[model samples]
Target: MSTNNIGPKRLVVGAHYGLKEWIIQRITAVVMVVFTIVLLVAYLISGGASYEAWAGLFSNQLMKLLTFLTFLSLFYHAWIGIRDIWMDYIKPVGIRLTLQTLTVLWLVACAAYAAEILWKV
Candidate 1:
């Protein structure tokens, strides 16, 4: 086959991008671990078993900050994973571009919404 007609090598290129995704996944995983541990410890210390107690805890500034970070990291991690899947499986260039665009927009929207809610809290 002529080199000109050789379609982009799928799995090889996919793996190239996968390395970056792998790093992002690991970083996000670490963030999640720390966030989970801290959140659990905070909850345990608060002993806020009731709904109102939990609400109060969430209303606190520090807790709100932590919550925002937790959600943001989660959204980012999910976005990266889904994007990788799309890049690997979606072979059509136009469709892949559109999906990637939508993914980024969604992530930004989610992050903005989280920030707004956290700010209000």
Candidate 2:
């Protein structure tokens, strides 16, 4: 006969991406900050709010590549955050899947649009 009381046997589970996602999010944030600072410095030194000034800034090959990288980082950061929101609040599997699909489609479309704009400029 064994009599040891444990409160209803706890179960612990996880998808195991918590720390990885957290670290990636921080890295993405730093990338965005650096991009913003670069843009700000360019703007200040250029000393013009004209469309031509801005166009010249992004017309450089290095600037274009950096801008694309920033775009990618921003999209990935948003995806992780939004996915977390959907996972935490939405309980129904079908509804969650639908939201996730919509989010992915929207993000992809935005990426395509960004590509078009970046290349055009």
Candidate 3:
């Protein structure tokens, strides 16, 4: 008797992140673009190129919140892209995990620094 390995009988593999990760990447990109536009507008309207004017722009509480949110989105976006790269190209499980761990640590540190800078503004 012949057997077929298709459809429900076929084994499914891979990261299974096609739709979800694609959506997240797009969303993060949009968030970053919006933040950039907002920052650009604010900078243009600030009407000065001095250090004090730049500081004053970030000094707003609303801007600070938006900045932090953008940073978070950026970090998350980086994480997803890097994680996918490691998963796809790194064959060794141990090395892939190590790289992923380091990526997480670096992104987290950046996020912390971002928060500190934003709050200090």
Candidate 4:
């Protein structure tokens, strides 16, 4: 039998999100954790859980900026995780793309709303 029937060999490479997403997930998680710790420490030191106390914690511009950054990290982390799920499970390209777009829009809207609220406070 002749061995020339097969076409040229092709190499298939996936989108390779392992390391990048892993690192990002960890970094975002750490950011959230650190924020939580900071918030906790402030709350503990203040010894008051009233609305006034909460208001005081966020009165500082630096704390507001840090809060915004933590939220940004949170949204991005969620996006990466959701994108991976769509890439892995959703078979149809069109549906996956549509869902991904919707997800992004939703996240962006939420982020914008968050920013507005953060500033308003």
Instruction: Highest lDDT: give the candidate number.
Output: 4
Candidate 4 per-residue C-alpha lDDT over 38-112 given as tens digits, one digit per residue, 9 for 90 to 100: 999999999989999988888889999999999999999999999999999999999999999999999999999
Q: Residue by residue across 46-106, what tens digits does model 1's lDDT show?
A: 7867777677778888878877877887888998888878988999999999999999999
Query: Model 4's lDDT to the true fold?
Result: 0.92
Better of 1 and 3 by lDDT: 3
Q: RMSD in angstroms, all models?
A: 5.2, 3.4, 2.1, 4.0
Clashes of each: 0, 0, 0, 0
The whole-model lDDT of each prediction reads: 0.81, 0.91, 0.91, 0.92
User: lDDT per residue, candidate 2, 66-115, as tens digits?
Assistant: 99889988998999999999999999999999999999999988888888
Backbone collision tally, model 3: 0
lDDT at residue 81 of model 4 (Cα atoms): 92
Model 1 misplacement above 4 A: 1-17
Model 3: per-residue Cα lDDT at residue 71: 99
List where candidate 2 sits over 4 angstroms from the true fold.
1-16
Order of candidates by TM-score, top first? Answer: 3, 2, 4, 1
Pairs in clash, predicted candidate 3: none
